[model samples]
Target: MHEPIVEFQNVSFSYGSRVALQHVNAVINKGDYIGLIGPNGAGKTTLIRVLLGLLKPSSGNVRLYGKNIKEFKDWHKIGYVQQKATTFDATFPVTVEEVVAMGRFAFAGVGRPLDHHDRHRIGDVLKMVGLDKVADRRVGELSGGQQQKVFIARALASDPDLLILDEPTTGVDVRSQHEFYHFLHDLNVHHRLTLVLISHDTDVVSTHVSRLLCINKTIMDHGCSIEFLLPSHKHNDVKKNEQIFKRVRHKH
Candidate 1:
């Protein structure tokens, strides 16, 4: 079941003349829970954009599910929940179920009414996220944590195999954040979802994820989260590893 899902080969990206990422190489396998951590302006978001096919790399290749991202068309199989759900307009008039139903548009097609299967999927995802009670409630009325869950449900409505979240806990409370990570853990272990989480909270990420991919404009380190948290002396390149860990820990 550990099949390759995402592959980055000698990938490099730039913004104008400023280099964002350089010669990055990594493989994310199916059922892997990976925490992607880095400092501010560390090219973490750039790498994600490249993987999502939003930005073309200056050099090298990105493959999603063994297909070159350029040719990959099964976008619904990959779900993405972007940062800052609380920042969404509170006045938007859509209901929670409506919002989640939007995720199925790719399969349902634009200007087309949702079929029974699509409606059932929307309900299943909402129930999966524990938001079935609020299905008919307006989305803007929900709390920040609930709003985050709604987005997660929206992403899940597509029935994606791989889920990617960018700073998902930004506006959530501490208690909610704790519960949120537990929910993510359940998705990874029980549902067999492949998760790629990008977060600034190193301690939280390290505790929850199976593997850690540390980066700062390059592939700084890649290994099990336990290995990453080990004492400096245990590493082959102790100085570089410690520095990268420190930079990630303190900066953000």
Candidate 2:
């Protein structure tokens, strides 16, 4: 059955005087794969931070799974693959398996070693993301696309119901990007994962996402992917290419 997984109610946020998000309201339902798009400094990342509870809304409320986000604690149910994961140092010397294993720490606390179940789960997630063969290889040694897969495997290790990704295709090759999109679609169809993906390219995601939310500090528009790119809404396109992508914060 469909249920609201994440909700924003008149949500507003500011960095002292500068506003990042204003009166944003949205209902994210189970099995809904929404593509969040916006021009530079449009608070896309800020909204994500708010949803993840990294920032508090200046007004209104945010909820996850029907509970206020501030009070919700079942973090393992929500998985995140941050944009910075691609820039991880190749010289760090950690193996792919070791990095993916980091996801287990959320369930088993720090300093605890993996038991048989944990190891098996790690292998399963690795295979799910097509990284099992390279499990023993140094993460830094893998190509950029392969490294990105490792981080995705790490996020899926928790078997989250909702998966959030920020610019997941950044730095990936064209072929790898298409593969990533297909993988996400498979996850949505087979695993019934509710996804929130932030991307700069509308054309790329228009074919895959069910919904599109266009924002510029506030929601300029939102609707089905087909309706979003219509002639009437074409003005919202910040660029035929990428915009001045920046995550602005309301700093005191």
Candidate 3:
């Protein structure tokens, strides 16, 4: 069995009187690629914040790599790419290499210059994401798709074991979306990196991610995508299940 990388035990969170998450429980195992889907205002982002330790759960516990979140200090082992991460000012003068170098600052001290090893890691991640040729180009010069890769490269520069991306392809072109997902597949298969992709593109997500986690304030469903897509033994039951899933996955 795969080891658990993240575990939420009876996790619940609230904003004053408003409950964002209630009694949420789930386990993300190593080498699992999970697609998180939900409608708007479904507490998806809140769940992520709680997992990342950005928010304290009102009642429950979270564990990272078998240690309580409060005691887990190996943050560099996880990489996060936020929504529309490619929307930076096009006129920014930073080079791709420089931007990727930011990921190393966590290993290298803040305000401290990157050493030889840091520079090597930056080059490796740029090549891994196929951005080596454009390493010297200004970030603004790249297409939206390429800019998105730059952020992914930045995340990988830390050699993180787990990667979490939130709506990564928000405004990219169709072709870029294809390329980005292909790279993600490669990373998961070849590198054995655990991945959590939060997206609303149910059609595309179902095809790529191995597991599906559907939520709306709480977990509506969680299982292999194949289980959700394939028909059950009884035809009527299959139709009924599909209808229920459609309702939960309403357009967001």
lDDT of 3 by residue, 1-252 (tens): 989999989999999999999988888999999888766677878899999999999999999999999999999999988887989787889999999999999756599998898999998899999999999999988999999999988888888999999888988999989988999999999998999999766657766787778766777544324343333424557665675456444421
Where does candidate 2 clash, by residue pair? 15-250
lDDT, each prediction: 0.84, 0.81, 0.84
TM-score for candidate 1: 0.87
lDDT of 2 at 228: 33
lDDT of 2 at 235: 65
| All models, RMSD in angstroms | 5.7, 6.7, 5.4
Residue lDDT tens for model 2, 176-228: 88888999998999988999888766667666787777766777533423333
Report how far residue 10 has shifted in candidate 1, in Å: 0.8
lDDT score at residue 1, model 3, on the 0-100 scale: 92
Ranking by lDDT: 1, 3, 2
| TM-score preference between candidates 2 and 3, better one | 3
